[model samples]
Target: MISVKNISKTFKLYQSPSDRLKEIILHRSYHRVFQALNNVSFEVKQGETLGIIGENGAGKSTILKILTGILMPDRGSVNIDGKITGLLELGTGFNAEFSGLDNIFHNATYLGLSRNDIEKKLDEIIEFTELHEFINEPIKTYSSGMVMRLAFSVAIHADPNAFVVDEALSVGDAYFQQKCMQKIKAFKNNGGSIIFVSHDSNAVKILCDEAILLEGGNVVQQADPETIINTYNFLIAKRSKGEDIRYQGDDTSSGYGNYMVRIDDVSLQDENNNPSEILISGRPAKIVIRLAGEETIDDLTVGIGIRDKFGQDIYGTNSFHLKKKICIKKGQILLIEYYFKEFNVGPGKYTVSVALHTGDTHVNECFHWLDKSVAFEVVAGGDDIFIGFVRLKPDFHIKSETGNKDD
Candidate 1:
């Protein structure tokens, strides 16, 4: 369990690196103070999980550091009951010169483990990391991912009563990440508390019982995981309008969002799950859209369209037309995938258009619209090809002129 009351953190910023030394030597003011947090308060109870969602520079990391005592807050009080283990950074307290095995023991010791206690957990840690023979190698020689493995394994095995897990789960492969999530769930099920901080709203929803939203170094809101996540998403989208100005379109594309929601990213994948901007004719194709909204959306309609180079619309459909209602909360990334059994396209260039809107037949309800969002070439294969926009796999009957037709 953890509790913070009226906590604040401020850092003095100097104009230059040398100014810091000058100020220290002169004992005068040579810097301006920047507030990293203000009146922040939250609690994580036993057997419960608390998720923190915020943008970069929103003081999410700053508060986590304060909780772990990696940094001291300039104001307010923090009271924590039980040992706190943080997965804030991978290999954070590791010594590069030490071997993986040695670093494990060192970290375990720091986590309040005795030599005998570490020895008891040693084999399990090594086995979980799958470092194998490399466990004896110097940590400096290991890849970033390998170091992460060793660090994560040791931290999780330390068995602290409360976990301060940041976004460190982004490391390693998908399978390994899933394994770590499983362990986190298992830990919480066994009466452990977690302060889970991440930008992933869905993960927060799935793993946490409560959530907090941070913005401009302030506690914006703390409430049900879904509500907080939705508010956070809306704030993020609103923020992006001013800070994110990169082109979301190309020569054959155009895009615009209504600030209600935005398509963050899009991808084309094959049946094997390999991504590409091109598709092979008659092969399975997938369109994956990464979507986020400003607030809770209950009647969202997601649509996708395919068109030829000449702007001929080949196909288009929306969730509403199919009688499927899509509901999502803010900050939650809706990774919607549309799977097509076959491209059925002829060799040529085509563009994919996608949109998110409300009110089935109302253009005014368009929250976001993208045209030619992703352009791809459908490469024709096989000698039995015809000239058209698509392949129908036609069935035909032919009779020779000199021969009589037979029924």
Candidate 2:
């Protein structure tokens, strides 16, 4: 288990080497102070994975460094119940002149393993990396993905009670990355604690029990993975405007925009044109949206997003993508309906999110954006029984041929 409390860090930026010398001799400050972290705190318990997400310069690296002992905090404290290992920046703690095989022993020793222990685990670690043929090559000759394989292999095999993973995994190929994810899941199942930092929301939703969002050296929000990811996306949309962004909605539903166009009502309709919370798979359906215009907008776009119960985005589209243009005038009410010839989604619970904005995306001019505005379930109705999230309507055929054995 790992615990952190109100930790902060600051760095002094100097203009030049002369400024540092002058400050020491004249007893005057000549550098600007940048606060990278401000009273940030969180905890990871055994068998739990906590995800840390934020934009660049949000103090993510600073906190990770402090936790791993690479940097000391200016205030607050950190406590760890057992040994912790970290996979930080790419190629960190490695010798460019050393062969990959040599670096294994080098890193294992630094992790406090005895020489005998390293020898015992060496074969297993090498096999996990799948780099048996290239293990003798110098580190400088290895690709980024190869270096990640070696580093991750060594870090996991160290057998620490907790692991701190940074974005180094992003450099690995898809196959190796999936292999690492499986190993991390196994570690979590065995009661190991983890602090996972990544910008990939899908991975966080799949692997994390909870998540935290950081902004400008502060902890903005901490909650379930779904909520945190939604909040993160909202912040990203507003980041360009340099506004003081904050979550403005509740746990069940969230929304943000300028209120030029408002979603007055949203509903799902079955083939019979009746309001419904349940829909049949492979049947006709439609989504009805009522909009009120508070200000005249020459260009407007309507978007819809469908998400599974786990908060994974299944499908999304917008009027802009469909090549449809809209214009609303003040005090005008418009009713919009999107008809589906056949809703091909699999049987599952899903939520519908709606958005009104200018252009194709909401980032430029978001008039309004609502998350989980309506919830519905799809039930199996056709003759086919399928598994997973979508129905692809597969067509299959088979033929038998007669031929000589040596044909």
TM-score of each: 0.63, 0.93
The whole-model C-alpha lDDT of candidate 2 against the native structure comes to 0.90
Model 2 ranges off by over 4 Å: 242-247, 399-407
TM-score of model 1 vs. true structure: 0.63
lDDT by residue (tens digit), candidate 2, 1-407 = 89999999999999999999999999999999999999999999999999999999999988888987899999999999888887899887899899999999999888878889999999999999999999999989999999999999998999989998999999999999999999999999999999999998888989899999999899999999989988887887777444633346876789887788899989999989999999998899999999999999989999999999888888999999999989999999998888998888899999999988888888878778899999999999866778788877776655456533431
In candidate 2, which residue pairs clash? none
RMSD of each: 15.2, 2.7
lDDT of 1 by residue, 1-407 (tens): 78899999999988899999998899999999889999999888899999898888899889989988899988899888878887887778899999999999898998899999999999999999999999988999998888878888888899788888887767778888788899999999999989998876667878889888998899898887755754554454445455332224345455655647778777899758899877888888899998987878888988888877655567888888988889889887788888889878788887788878786642536567676678888887664576787788865666678675543
What's the residue-level lDDT of 287 in candidate 1?
91
